[model samples]
Target: MTLFELTNSLKRTITESSYGQSEKHKLLQSEYVSHRELVQFYQACNPTPTLLSLIRQTKLHLPKYKTYKQTKTKEFLKMMEKLRLEAQEAEYRKLINPDPEHTTLYDTSNQEYVSPVQAHKELKNQLTTIVNVFISVGSVSYAVWYWTASSWGLRDSYRVLLTVFFGLLVLVAEVVVYMGYLNKIEEARAKESKKKEVKKVIKTYDLTLDNLTAEKL
Candidate 1:
């Protein structure tokens, strides 16, 4: 075909395409100085239309289209949440593939489970118990000192019993604080697991949307 025929055919396709008015405005605004590059891009699908169009045609909708303020706010917040989730997924991918020096081992030929942290924790608990016994003994010694020096004799059995009870209370308080620390650790693990599940759910939704979009096109 002649050059003029080819150019006319390209213009025809561009003018007949499904680009929106705002999109056409942008394309026409940032067009090449020569006017030929602009025609080429519009005809060849060189650059995609704006993300707004794609989103509108998908399961998502725009806020302006909704009349109620509450609906608009909800839609805007949902959009932001989706964007934030996708961003976190991208960040997770970057973290998983940080550097070539720290490649992940995928081979499962020789697998052996190890729990060094759990083993260390068990040992630490045993040591903590030993320390608690020592603390209890020390408290008993203090109680005995006070009882002997402050005019309390073995004849007053109730006073000696009360002192022993207070010493046991101190040991119980220490154990309660130790148990709180373990509870905090468990809460942190649960939070991390929840985040992982949320990420997985978002990724699955994105994949389903992508497949639907492909089918539609």
Candidate 2:
């Protein structure tokens, strides 16, 4: 299949999958396309564009996106657990101090609250853009360093060997930077999840007056 066709096919197949309400479904969005799978698929083609070039054209970052998604999923689950516990604690406190005036001590519903997640959500798009910029910056810096330093003051044989060594170093560093960037994305996602969880815990439950009156009746 053609490059675009192949890429789209992969995306369409995965995105259209009926993964139900599981976190897997959320992680399977098109943005989270896997780079390794793309590379392997393209490599199998008789004539395909360079992997990097294709990625540049498509601007799909599976690795970073996957990390971001997985982090959010993990934090979502963790936050849910914490919120559940807090909910139970609030209930326990409510039972202990049944006075209506004391309910605010545990629930804190009196003041206006802005969710940290909602407040900082705009930063997520910009953050991902910054990470994508790093891919280019890392590559260009490696090229400049490789050619300039490798060509300076060494014998031809030594220069060649140094080039290989430096080349490997650059490659390793690039990988490290990419990995670190993904981790950063993941952390950002988790932070947002935590903020949402906090909001959920604080404003989560509201006992309606009608329900209680009906129960009494």
Candidate 3:
């Protein structure tokens, strides 16, 4: 049978078989599943034929759209953790009593609140776009390469070697670009964080100075 026919038959057979939702499926969706499975069947290379079979069976159930729920959860956790730490810091600041102890002066200026989490969130949005694009393009390319390589003798030892090398090169380039984007995002977040810190310090300094001046009167 032609590869297309073979693939279709396999897909149809698996879809007709019994499959049900399970915790494992949720985990797979959250971490392991990728578009390459749709294009190249690389997921079948897994040592667990049973799991591979399930993957094929559940292909029809895979969502057409990408969801970054896991990433959002991670960001939310980070934000909450930061907020907790900031609260503790605020408590410590109050304890230290920056205003002169000799005077009954109190500086009640509100602290400037800046959230670096928003920057992280925006970065995640951009990264999600990049990831979707990469997966879509990579899957399509792999499908085309796999289909034509052998037919054109490109899958022969010498040619296959070159094919593999070129594929690896593309993979490396994609990884580098992905990492570069992440680093740029991190730098942007760092800059925003620095600004927040500077502003926070300035506010504290101004309040302290104002309080001290009032005490001399």
Task: Estimate every model's Cα lDDT from 0 to 1.
Answer: 0.57, 0.56, 0.55
- Greater lDDT among 1 and 2 belongs to 1
TM-scores of all candidate predictions against the true structure: 0.32, 0.24, 0.29
Output the better candidate (1/2) by TM-score.
1
Q: Which ten-residue region of model 1 has the weakest summed lDDT?
A: 53-62
What is the clash count for each candidate, in the order shown? 0, 0, 0
- As a whole number from 0 to 100, the lDDT of residue 45 in candidate 1 is 59
lDDT of 2 by residue, 119-190 (tens): 587477557765765665566556655665666754656656655566566667766876798799778866
What digit string (tens of lDDT, one per residue) describes model 3 on residues 108-167?
333323358967886888788678766755675566567667566454565555555666
Candidate 1 lDDT over residue span 70-154, tens digit each: 5468888999999999999977976864443434577332223337897898798879886976688577757765776577554
Root-mean-square deviation of Cα positions for candidate 2 versus the true structure, in angstroms: 32.9
Task: Name the lDDT value of residue 81 in candidate 2.
Answer: 97
**Candidate with more favorable, higher lDDT: 1 or 3:** 1
